[model samples]
Target: MAYYPAEVKEAARGLYCKRYSIREISRTLGIPRRTVYHWVDAEAWGDMLSHEGVEDAAQRRLVLLITRDDKTKADLQEIDRLTSALERFQRLREREQAMRGEPCETASAKPEQQDQRGTREKRERKGGDSRSGKRRGRVIKNDVSHLTPEDFKAQLHQHYFAYQRELMQAKHYRNRQILKSRQIGATWYFAQEAFEDACTTGDDQIFLSATRAQAEVFRDYIIQIAQQKFDLELKGNPITLHTAHGPATLRFLSNNSKSAQGYHGHVYIDEFFWIRGFKELHKVATGMAAHKKWRRTLFSTPSAVTHPGYGLWNGDWYNARNKVKRQQFPGFKEMQSGILCPDNTWRKIITLEDAMAGGCDLFDLNDLKLEYGPEEFENLFMCGFVDDTNAVFLLPQLQACGADPAEWADYNPKLPRPFGNKPVWCGYDPSRSRDDASFVVIAPPEKPGGMFRVLERFKWVNKSYLWQVARIREITQRYNVQFMGIDTTGPGIGVYENVRIFYSRATSIHYSVQTKTELVLKGRELVESNRIQWDAADKEVGLAFMMIRQTTTPSGAMTYAANRSESTGHADAAFAILHGVSYEPLARPRGGCRVVIG
Candidate 1:
């Protein structure tokens, strides 16, 4: 037997817990292998290893190392490696449990107690309470007590652009109004903000978008942030988070004011300018956050000036409400710099240029300018409202065509056959040079005079004509496509020719002034009669229709045309839709008179 200091024994034990071999521990600690083995047996180290998982042992070592005052560089390196290993192990465990259809333990649960807790739950479910013959209610837990405001600032807010940070700093205001450029991440930032607020303050959070699909985007972002940043799996539709304050609910809703009524929480209304019946939706939103403690945030890209939300943004609505005491608001330039209006609303205008200056590197300015023509570029990325007065499709009429896709109980895009033997119409508008081609799947009227529902829309960029035709063929397999209309001008000729080989019902449309007029007129009738509807989230469809203005041809004849060029035809989606609906014929069929076109 050889004598060893207490420090040496402790060092050997620590190394052994870190999964070092006995021989390695001996060599590292300058001790004999026989003595290390003797200490390990005497201290019951094998029993400890049997009781603790690898993650538990690593966590124990990591905590010991972090608490030491005289840590060497090697100690810090070991800490970093152990932390990373623990994270990877946790993720792997979660994946394995998911594969086995087992529920993962909460982040706050100890590894040693997880098995015992799961077994207890199973036993409780199998045998009801011996006395009452009632099973215990299943606990729905979303433990977020470990999360601090500091954690959110470090993990999430650090990645925000300058404009996003500005929005955060203005959280004290009762109301926030933001007009931003497309794809500038306004919704993304607000999702994080609301989640953080809900987690920390236990305040209920509500998200309202133009459609349920858009509202779910916020919920998805929140779930992703919780999982990636904090190792939390937030479940349930209106996710209930168990925070230190209490349990708080996060609700996601659409612009249907009737369904949104009676909810009280912090409300975030997304894409308000594009929402139909904005005035009614605004009333519902205000009622939701009626309390002084709750906040309201409204954000969107600019839509047509005729939109009801435009009045709320430009101060006209406020002026009308306060006719006796009118207050002057800051000009557009001043608003671009962000300001608190006299009505106590914090307002800001963030254009693509402002977003770029604020550290958003997602767009090439010249490329976007060329992709969307001047009018579209101005409206979408420059925070300029559309003047739809001269357009064939006015904003009010086009807005009336917007509907919530969630209301369609018969359709599910996730299924293999979304429409399930029901007849569908598909329309394709081929791309011009450097411009995106548009395709649409529409559900025609169910009865003699019912509604036309746009089910799906796709935009293909820089794809070969063969690829486009292949995609169309795949759609035919999924849907019982009764009619397919393709424009046979420019690149469309290639697609139409190839599609005709497989789908005989494919119709070729040759574009002329008269042809376009007929297509535009039929579309107009559909819009005016409230017969055509699309997902409210598809604001681009409305913008596309707005692009078709009454124009004069080189011969001075009146014609309807978008800002068309090799680089700038933004009406592809609108034309694609018109192409599909044209199969119904320009004039409505009278009794016993069915007029169909191929």
Candidate 2:
């Protein structure tokens, strides 16, 4: 089930208040019927992807500390001790104040308590951080006192702290996948490291996009911190962050076009899988490449499937700090063998095969599902893609369909009668690329009583649609004059139009045309799933019906695939007529045929 975004909840709630019908509510929400009900009640309201609720604001910050490896056990213990001591010391001081008659004491003592609780280690270790000779990856690590913004405050047996300077200048990147556990402010710190690119000695461009609206909020937090702590201002108005240089906007963009264009900077796309389409993302990446000195960063919230941005961002600056800390890395099989990866340094946490492996006694699907959502979950998790796994026209069925007739002494594509050499039923598939195709054919059996043996199964290829048409016409006559169905989704329409004009000049066969996409919808309506069956003597009729259905099968399949929740019918009328003939005898004999009501 698709979850409703929180911002749309009020609009969703207004449905009952406005007393709109479910259909009207859906129209208002611009969603499907199921989504209308999904947002109808408060429980459904909670289903909205929201982070708001009752929690101590500081408790929220507490998560920041526990998640990263900046703080140590000793530091936490000392903070606790100082806090308790400071609390008691304040009580005694307040007692002394009572003797002198002041207002009841407040947590005013918290300042000194906080001083001891928060900064006691800072003071104790102030000079200690300057101590030298702590050699780390290509750089000497300093104590907490000598930490750089890029570095986490160091915690031995934990994460490396305060190493930003060393990270940027690291000689080589270790190629590995990194998986951060929960409670590691890895996200904030990850963005912080990227933000450091913005604030460091040399300026750099950055782009950050989120899967959903709230994910965009994380970028705002990073920007706010950059402004207050690091002297970076989010630029642009109607404003997002603007760069000090030419036209690089450091703005939070939703996964849509809002975030994809007009930037020449290192991209930091967060929660990449949450966003559905990447057409815009590709456009932005290509635009960024045009800038020459660009870099890219990707942040993900570990959705059910990893997105394109994650694989691509590995090329440029990724978390060198994570590598320094020995965090696990991740990879992608979906990215076409890492073709999208950044050239400089690459990392991945898991492969598709390992992602589906059973690690413990109880196998968990989180490995597969967590990396991707349903739309991508199949490829990311299942690691296989096919047109239809359980298609009725299975390979075996298709093999049977393509099988040569036993009665034929020799195989031939030559037409036998009315459609002689011209063509009859054209099966057009526009292009079986992501877009559906228009399958078409001209003629099958020469006469009305004959079967439609396979003609050209016209697959569409653009620009050279003529190549296909030329191929079809090469065998079939140029001027026999029969009806044709051209897929027309891609070049077929233009081909059909242009061919009609050319043939009017070049040939005598007056070809009538049916635009397959338009006609197929009508065809599906006629079939209505009543079941098509015929007898031994009705072989010609049965083959004609099946041929008609095959010509229109793609449309029916697409419609049913989209509306799998509902039952639909089939297409019969589309194939009922044999061929549109140019010349016929004055009185054609009517075949023994009846439209059965049952």
Candidate 3:
């Protein structure tokens, strides 16, 4: 063991507290990285680092530099700069406290001015002044009183892409239905639009998604936009903004029909095609915005054609239900550039190509094409819905498995032990074309014939097998993992070997025709029985399951397979889930099946 002086150790600790990487600290202090790690662990440096704020860290560093026997000119300069910064931070804190109506030490020293200010405030309150009138009611946290319509338009014009402007231009229509490619910033744009509308018009904005977590994405985007564009921090769920007109509430809600009953506002439904029980949800959603003043916006990438929203998309539901004479609707091509239909709905289809043409440069077109299969590419990015007739797992049956994970009162992912001593099954499907691998954590039934809930699923791309195993090991520390199933046909074999060393319960699954058949059959049985559930927001799981199709091998035997070539990183989620569910056997051995000769 090499000895490090007290000064050197103190310097390393200071650097660590200053947010330097351990390797960086080690190199700077001329100590071995292992020694620094040991010191950090033994002295609990991480706890100190986390609890120490910026000002405290700077003060500590300044003290350390001041006590040093040998200091450079740069050190003296940094000391002077930090001292000035600390003074400025103190002044800013005092100003903030004064603004918040708290008596600051400096403000208290001047009693005459404080007394005059208090007298004026009291007189204004008693005399029914306009400023005091605005402050008399419930205090709104995010006040946008000074923001003008021109200010909003300026921000929008500067930040929005061309397609977003098109959506904005069509805001006059009462009903707008958009079919868009995945990840073209539709949710973000809608969040911005809703916030602006709520602020300017004082109209309530309601955002709906398949699950509460998904709905919060809208809330997050709104908060981010407000802070970035206007330097305002909005607070509260269903945030109420105090505007020039009045107080406007922004409600973020899941597709729970019961929870969405009474609100009246402009409604935005995100990923409507992927939501289960869409007809019921749509009924509640439409009822909320039944008034002529409220607008309805529905937007999503395409899902399976079997979804109920498909009828609404093709105008089949509209034509069949209405007693009025049936009207001919525009074809898909005619609607691509947007059209106002006879049903009084303005509809548009924006494919990936259209988004690119509209100047969204966020995606690499070639990479996306190479990453997804032809069918997936068309369905997910070209506004084409899945034709699931040949699929082994139909959308309707899989829809039964969609659930809101937020309703699980027992599980909190933020905790260190989210499932706390409850046994969870883990499954891994290794990468096939060095593209993508998937891992899942599934909570099995507490009682016989109960439900299996998928708690978490992760996808890794182009990572080594050791890294995958390390992640599995970390998951074990957080979960009570009783069973782990790993596909050992290819790179999975390496993962299985490493995992089994630490987790004795880890099971190796080698794929053959019979094994694949058994896995798919077991998974299908679970789905058909409605015994499995996953987060409703996760559309990928349903898509992965729908990718599997029945085909014949060279010997004319029926088999199931998904597109798993290099061009398409396919169905890993479905197989990972199957690996976990396969822990439950296809069948218990019957009494008659046992041979006496055995």
Candidate 4:
């Protein structure tokens, strides 16, 4: 018992080098279990406890249980809260239905279906009182290089919704990151932050980008709302009160992501997580227009674990949350010795209904401990570091067919086909030196409900791929495949002739043979875009040809070369030279049979 400083001996002991159970040491030494184990002697403790020093004693088990990390607990609580809210809402809805004397059982139930019911004829919002949300006055400042807190608040209020205020912050010019969440108002908050910066920070430009043109179009409301609601003049360079007559110059860009590159004052990318195809994102990253003084803020709702936006936000938020966790962690030492101490005290906004079962709020904040907790924070708030998942569309939007086997075939997914009895069009993407088999198939929708159904697909190992083309004759006859398109690399006339010979059944009677290249003219005419009806599947070089179709032709025959890539034949340069035919449907028949042949 020759005394040792309180933590001096504990600091030297490490996690498992202790004597007695963690609880035993704690009770014997009048110290917490974590500290007791920290001071334990490993040489002697090894004979009694495991490497982690967790023991087999019943009392130690009861007292030494590891509590959950905070973020995890927060997520669990959120799930519970949402689930509970949904349940309560459903019950309330049913009660309202009963009051109205309607069937309250199914989604398709009608009010007139039931008669006898409850007493009250009306229903209101949840909780005791129907009032929802707390209102707070906000200030927004503009037209200055810097801002007072009051001015900033004014600017923020102009754009901040109540639910969004939690994620909103003073715009930091040095950082470029995205904010992600589950049904959170991160995007709207960032928009407000950008609007404030655009108005107040002189010479600071602001660009708020959304996933679609429709979505970005709504950002104009910020200016309208600020001017009308707040009675603020967000015009003439909210920067130097100078009379530069322009439309409240906060430019709202739609997926105009490329424009976001090489010029950065302030770029707020909304719904960033849904952006697929890293090629464009990489352009923004490397060409990030932000000058030394510019900043970028990305915001989106979380949809996938591997989204590029998800990866980025996860990184910074992870480290930040962990800092707070380490600070309170009794045994662990702090790793980051830096200027920014982590402030991980984010309180969740819960429904009053959620707290009814438990006293006050029963959100358990300890379940969030994880190696990826900081990443979760990044995903939940700031998207700074991102993953590059090679996708061209949002995963959520890219829903594959269901597991139900019957719906596999004849199931008109999406909408009705766009073709409208238009002859089926086909495009062939032959493999170059690649290992996978060349894929030649029919695609494009006719009506809104039209979707791509693989009529015939094949994998060719060698020249035998052409052997499969013979089946195209049967498929053409089977479906109404009028015209077939092929990739002929570049100006290669010789290879085109060779593939045409292989596909031509005119000599064999399998079906008519037409070089797919020649069909290009017909595809230009009939196929809306050499591109496709946007069946929305990943095409090899198919998308290139489709862009060709988008181009309006000089002859009034729509040109098929509008938004094509440099490597037109890159996917199947040789296939373009191959033979494919365009079958144009003719007018009426003689005997009233009305031949609908292609």
Estimated TM-score for each candidate: 0.76, 0.28, 0.75, 0.31
Which residue ranges in model 3 land beyond 4 Å of their true spot? 1-139, 322-324, 565-569, 589-598
Q: Which candidate has the top score in lDDT? A: 1
The whole-model C-alpha lDDT of candidate 3 against the native structure comes to 0.82
Q: Summarize candidate 1's per-residue lDDT along 1-598 as a digit string, tens digits.
A: 9776454565566567656667657765567899988998898988758887788778777755654445679888998999999999989988987898665642434433443553454445457467886767454366665577999989998899999999999999999999999999888899999999987887899999987789999999999999899777788777877665566789998777866888899999999999888898999899989999999999999999889998888889999999999999998899988899988899999999999999999999987776677887898999999998778899989989998775564466766677655789988887565636899999999886789999999988777888888999999988889999898866788888889999988998888788888889889989999999998888889999999989889999888888665545668889999999988877665753534333
What digit string (tens of lDDT, one per residue) describes model 2 on residues 1-598? 7765443444455433323346655764566877666556535543332453322222332332322234578647644655566566668777986897642323223333423322333444334334563322211111112224443223211232322222233312322123222222334554655554443312334444432333445566666655555433453321322222111234444444543455555555553433345446656654664554555444333322123333344432245434454432234443422222334443333223342231212234563243222323443334322232232222112212222121121122332322223344433333322222223333334454444443323323232566655654652443243444343333336445655653432212211223232233333322233211111111122222323222224444422121101121111112222111112221236762322110
Q: Write the per-residue lDDT of candidate 3 for residues 255-360, one digit (tens) a residue.
A: 7776689899999999999988899999999999999999999999988989999999888888998758888889888888889998899999999999999999
Q: Could you tell which candidate, 1 or 3, scores higher by TM-score?
A: 1
Weakest 10 consecutive residues of candidate 1 by summed lDDT: 106-115
Q: Where's the lowest-lDDT run of ten residues in candidate 2?
A: 562-571
The digit string of per-residue lDDT tens for model 4 on 1-598 reads 4444433333233222322345534443345666544445434545545533222232233222211122356445644555555566678877897898754332321222211111111111112223544332111122222233476566455444433443353343244443333333444455556555554433335543433332343365555645654454443212222111211245544344553544445555555555555336635743554366555555444445554444344344455556655443111112111111232222222122222232323233332212112333333333222221432222322322101111122222221232223345454544333222344444434443244333334544444443545654554544445556544443222223454664452211011223322444443333332222222222222222322223343555543232223322222321321223222222214442322112
Best by TM-score: 1
Task: Put the candidates in TM-score order, highest first.
Answer: 1, 3, 4, 2
lDDT of each: 0.83, 0.36, 0.82, 0.37
Stretches of candidate 1 off by over 4 Å are 1-140, 591-598
**Inter-residue clash pairs, candidate 1:** none
What's the count of clashing pairs in each model shown?
Answer: 0, 71, 0, 79
Compare candidates 2 and 3 on lDDT and give the better one.
Answer: 3
Worst ten-residue run, lDDT, model 3?
589-598
